[model samples]
Target: MRDRHLYLLLLPGLLLILLFRYAPMYGIVIAFQEYNIFKGIMGSEWVGFAQFARLFRSPDFYEIMRNTVLISLYKLAASFSLPIILSLLLNELKHLVFKRVTQSVIYLPHFVSWVIFSGILISFLNPIDGLFNAILANFGSTPIDFLGSSAYFRSILVISDIYKEVGWGTIIYLAAIAGVNADLYEAARIDGANKGRQMWHVTLPAIRPVIIILVILSLANILEAGFQQVFLLYSPLVYDVGDIIDTYVYRVGIQEANYSYATAAGLFKSVVAMTLIITVNKLVKMSGQDGLW
Candidate 1:
């Protein structure tokens, strides 16, 4: 009874999960039914795995899978690594004021919503009187429709993602770096280790556990290819390369009113993501790092 107040403090969060998360999960039954807004869940026709079957049979499924995986891999390589590099650089800065200012400037874009950022991106890559096009004109180069071209769309996605997230992503790594023992640095200096060698040997090894955990988490979400960013920036011209599972679900579900199909697709994604996390966690544990479990 002495800890009753502490338990009370946890009540709201527990209730939130029960009500908003677990309660709403009951609706997942509709994924096995021919869901109808008018007929409701109880009244809907039970289709079993028909929706999943249809999803597999669709020609667009393979293409969407390819695009989703490719884009996600691009982001995993660029967005993930850049942040570690940036955090290391930030930690090495001797000038506190410059470091703080640089951090603020780089992380500022993370506060901007994708909607507003997309609008800004659209203006710069318009290809006709846009900033890039104007610069190209001065150099006697032709205009390029970056967002409309399949050739450049994925690159743009990766680059813009890096711009918006790289700095913010560094926050976790920076925190981990900060927690590294100062005595390790002193030992490195005593051994005549230079700055770069100290960071590589002492700093990085200290934060290896954190990096591994993040890598596992990143792999778990490998199917999520940034729906909002792609939806805002893509057109039919680039859909061949830019269309992902989320965008596909939005189109097939919201636009075409295929509720059951959409649910099946979403559930499939969730299962795959869960499997990824489990597999990665096992691999990490085998490699001698602690797992999320």
Candidate 2:
């Protein structure tokens, strides 16, 4: 009877996943068909792997793939360790007021919608009269159009994404750090370990499992380079450098109505992401770490 209430509480979440997540997976068949709106799924002509073949043969395929992988890798490299570092630094703060205020200020950006954030970014980065250019003018520098330049676009994407997300990412690390045994720190201090040494030997090792799990999960989305952020930030001027798989699919599928072709591209991303998650999880398990199983 006690377990009955817990099972009842779990039912809604299970139903939601089954209805909205698993049920929709059936649409993946559209990627293998010449889907027509009028004919619908059942009547659509099956074209086997023709859509996937076409996607591979397209001239833009390699460019899109390169841009996607490079951007995601850049973000992973630049932003992954920042939260861990921030959590460590924040943990060392002695003043509660300063720590709380600093955390609140940083975490504020995560709640802002991408649409609003993009607008703010455009206004701030504007070349002629924007804040950045205004500052440059004082330094006697020529105003540079950041968003319009391919050279600067990718950097802007990475930096802005990091700014918005780094604080939120710290939450998990902070929680993990909080759970570390206090006795370990005392033991480290008795061993003549300084603050840095304690963090290295006690705090970081205690949080290693959480870090490993998060890293493995992040690998699953290696191809997903933030669709909403990229879509809102990119322009034709920076397409060569800024376009990713998701944006490419949006342009081809939604804008051009090549649904099957676009679906093939999406399906390709999904398959690769799934394979990555499984492979990385297995590797983590082999290393004696807990995995998503």
Candidate 3:
């Protein structure tokens, strides 16, 4: 009875998840059906495994999967490591105002919607009159189409992703780092450790659990290379390098209206993602770290 208020505090979030997250899950049935718009789920013709088989048979499926994995891995690697380095550097800044200002500057990009951000990016990278081309022109070089070029698109995606989210990840780690015992740092200093050594030995170890948890989550979500960002920034020329599972689903499912096939593609990605979370969580537990459970 005493905890009733605490439970009340949780009710809104629970209700939100049920309404927006779990409720839409019923649509997963479309993966197994022809899914006519006029005929509802009950009235749709069922064809077991046909959608999956069709998806597997498509020539583009392998290329799409490969691109998704590669781009996701690129983002994960850069996003995961740079934040730790940044957090450690930020923690070392004894000047309180400077640290706060630096954090605010970096964190500002996280709030910008991908739509607006991508427009800014597109304008900056425009082959004819973009900021980058103007810079190149100053040096007497021809303008290069950064976004359209397959060679540069993936790199741009990774760099832009880092620019946007690295600070947010750093904030999480800084919070974790803040919880480390001051005595641990003192002990490290007493043991003749320099500031760098103290951070490596005391700080990083203290936050290993948080790092592990984030890694597990990142790995599980490895299939989801950013949909909105890619949808906005990518062009047909760069689609060979940039098309991920989510974008593919939007094009085929939403635009082309091949609902069943799209659902099947999405379902496959979800199943793989679920398996990844389970497998990675189990591995983390085996290595004696706390899993998400």
Per-prediction backbone clash count: 0, 0, 0
The per-model lDDT (C-alpha) reads 0.94, 0.93, 0.93
Q: Mind giving the per-residue lDDT tens digits that candidate 1 earns over 171-231?
A: 9999999999999999999999999999899999999999988998999899999999999
Structural similarity to truth (TM-score) of each candidate: 0.98, 0.98, 0.98
Off by over 4 Å in 3: none
| Top candidate, metric TM-score | 1
Looking at model 1, residue 234 earns an lDDT score of 91
Candidate 2 clash total?
0
Looking at candidate 2, the ten consecutive residues that score lowest on lDDT are 73-82
lDDT of 3 by residue, 191-240 (tens): 99999899889999999999999999999889999999899998789878
lDDT for model 1: 0.94
Clashing residue pairs found in predicted model 2: none
Residue 199 CA error for candidate 2 (Å)? 0.6
